[model samples]
Target: MFGKRNGLFFDGKITLEQGDPEFIELFSRFAYDEVVNEPGAQHPDLDDATRSMAILATLIGCQGVDAYEMMLPVALETGVTPVQVKEVVYQA
Candidate 1:
């Protein structure tokens, strides 16, 4: 799902790395809980594609590559298109 880290500072995974330190810190605090405990914390009304699009939109906005990778299978399962997902993150 991700590539190798090129340098010692990073893991070279599919990641998002453009945000304030505070946001990054807070996101780190609960990101695990959200991924582990509340995988469906986002919109539950929409189908997978829409839901995945929402996730993609958010992760890209927050620069959260790990979460994005973790959700990839779900996105695909929910029928999200590569085009749609790419569109969501293209301008990020």
Candidate 2:
């Protein structure tokens, strides 16, 4: 989280806990801790770039353009290249 925090988060919370505290809490607990950090959900063989690409594809398929735009920079920072992102979009 800290490594990807520069643009995606502010002071340990996304958008400085904007809107409602509950939203931040739920997202942090469920998305960050419970799901993303779950031991069983992680793959030692899959690098960050691969994971980010897959996530971008998922977001595109889900029609999460707003979220995709928000996360694109972070994905790049985490090692996902622009070409990979484009291919994911192309594939979708």
Candidate 3:
């Protein structure tokens, strides 16, 4: 419940509401250490800002409103500016 409200992007209670279940599950497994944690399926070694950029690109490509909104905190955490996010979208 708090995960839904603690962030500004997603309106629903679960990642399924914001993005595909497969995407969420894949990202979760890759983002953490305890899950599937496949070496070949791992996320790229990017800084937080770059990671945000990649996420923004994926969201924009998918037209994922919930995912896009939810990524704001990660973008901020990664020092990815709003302008950067927009730029990535425009470039994509």
Best by TM-score: 2
Candidate 3 TM-score, C-alpha based: 0.53
Give TM per candidate: 0.49, 0.69, 0.53
Worst 10 residues of 3 by lDDT: 1-10
* TM-score of structure candidate 1: 0.49
Q: Which order, best to worst by lDDT? A: 2, 3, 1
Tens digits of per-residue lDDT, candidate 3, 30-62, equal: 677544355544466656688678788888889
Q: lDDT for model 3, on a 0 to 1 scale?
A: 0.72
Which regions of candidate 3 deviate over 4 angstroms?
1-36, 40-45
Tens-digit per-residue lDDT, 2-52, candidate 2: 443644553465454554778789878998788877785778898878888
Clashes by residue pair, model 1: 16-63
Per-residue lDDT of model 1, residues 1-92, tens digit only: 33436422255443344435567777787776655467565546866688778888888788799988998778988898788777877766
Task: Score candidate 2 by TM-score against the native.
Answer: 0.69
Model 1 ranges with Cα > 4 A deviation: 1-45
